[model samples]
Each structure stands twice: as structure tokens, then as C-alpha cells.
Target: MSVSVDSPFVHKVWNDSELSKMVDGGVQFPMLSDQGGKIGTLYGIYDEEGGVETRGRFIIDPDGIVQGFEVLTPPVGRNVDESVRQVKAFQLVRESEGSEATPSGWQPGKKTLKPGPDLVGNVWKEWSVKDNYDK
Candidate 1:
């Protein structure tokens, strides 16, 4: 889901005029309206002076907890691929019940670090950057 200060009508126009061209059938998720920046304010992205919200992406867990988030100015576009990757990593961690941790750039089927005393200072031996990048 996406939340922005734009009204529902503006979201429709944006989908019709621009977003639709980039993704088939426009965005697949709901584009929520935050006309008064109320939701943005709660998320700390609301810019009172500009009356606009900075671009932000938040990943909330099933328990209503924010697992991760990213905020950036409008000039820099967000990375959807990276967001998806992070979501996958988070899911994997949750599935493991906190026993495993993903290394940087970790992907599905890649090596994951197990949290324990043995791994405290032996992460270098357990996993390497090449593990995340090697095919």
C-alpha cells in the first residue's frame, strides 16, 4: 500500500497519466490518500512547512510493528527491487524464529548466519560477502 498527501482523484490521474506506463494496470496495491498529512505526521515524514510528505517506505509486520523503513527526498526515486529483497529477507528471518540472520545482499537459498555464542566472533568464517553474490 502507498500513502501520500495527494487526494484519491490525484492518485487516479497519476495512475492514468504516468504510473500505468511503468507498471501494468498501474499499482497493484492501494494508494491511500493523506490529504492533511495526518498519517504522514505519525510516520514523521510530514513536512509542515512544505505541506508535503517526504517519500518514505515502511514495512510493517503482521504484529503491527514496523520492521524496517526508508525515507528520502522526492528528488531520489526509491528502489523497489531493494525493498522487495528486504521484505524477503525479513520474511526469512521471521520464518526462522530469530535463529537465523541474513547477510548483506542476502537472497533466498543463500547462506544465513545462525545467532549463537559460537557465531559471536566467527561470522567471518560462517559467511562471506561472496556467499551473497556467488551464483
Candidate 2:
């Protein structure tokens, strides 16, 4: 991600290794070691049973309101590339004109659609392309 132009964290890991081990070694950045995940519990992002930090991104605007919040499983990679774009989009829109509701694949400099009657037709059009896709 460091090489990528548009990305959030410079580095990230999906494996469930002992985060404390990172502390033992000399990591340039300081990491909050959640032994029993007490801090994680307060944030409601800690996995007590599983004993790991759930991959998540918290995009809080200047007003301290969360514009975007995403949490994903360990197997699935979190899109840090998209998160940076989202943060920029949120800040830009908040500065220019007040709006909400970011559509899928939303990115900076791209047109963000405002949710209303107009979106219904667009959504319907997309739904029409049914290929029996499943998660």
C-alpha cells in the first residue's frame, strides 16, 4: 500500500498472530497492546472469544461524526485503498455542500449520488442484471 497512490495504512496484516509479539520486537510505530482486549471491548471492536482485533476502518469527520465504518472477517482483506478515497470524499463534500449516503464503489473526484427518488430507477436498473450471484 505504500507504493499505491490511493491507500490508507502503509501496511496491514490479516493473520491472527500475537499482536504483543510486535511489541517485543522494535516496531517503529507504537501499538496499543490489548492483552485481554479491554480497550477493544470499550470500542466494541474487540473479539474476546476469538482473541483478535477485527479488521475495521473508522472514518470520523471533523465534526467527530463517523461518516463511514467498515468491519470485515480475517479471510477478507479490508480495502484500505478505498478507505482513503472515502475519507477524502467525505471531507470534500462536507466542505463544499452538505450531503450523505455514499454509494458502492464511491471514490474521490467521482460523482456521488444523493439518495432520493432518482436513485430508485438507477438501483432498479442495476438489479435487472441478475446473474444469480451469491456471497
RMSD of candidates 1 onward, in order: 1.5, 9.4
> How close to the true structure is residue 116 of candidate 2, measured as C-alpha lDDT?
67
Over 18-61, each residue of candidate 2 has an lDDT whose tens digit, in order, gives 43365564344433455676655765777767877676667877
- Model 2 has an lDDT value of 0.57
Give the least accurate 10-residue stretch of model 2, judged by summed lDDT. Answer: 1-10
Cα lDDT of model 1 by residue, 8-91, tens digit: 999999999999999998989899999999999999999899999998889999899999999998899998889999999999
TM-score of each: 0.92, 0.54
Per-residue lDDT value at 126 in model 2 = 39
Q: Quick one: best TM-score, which candidate? A: 1
Which numbered prediction scores highest in lDDT against the true structure? 1
In terms of lDDT, model 1 sits at: 0.90
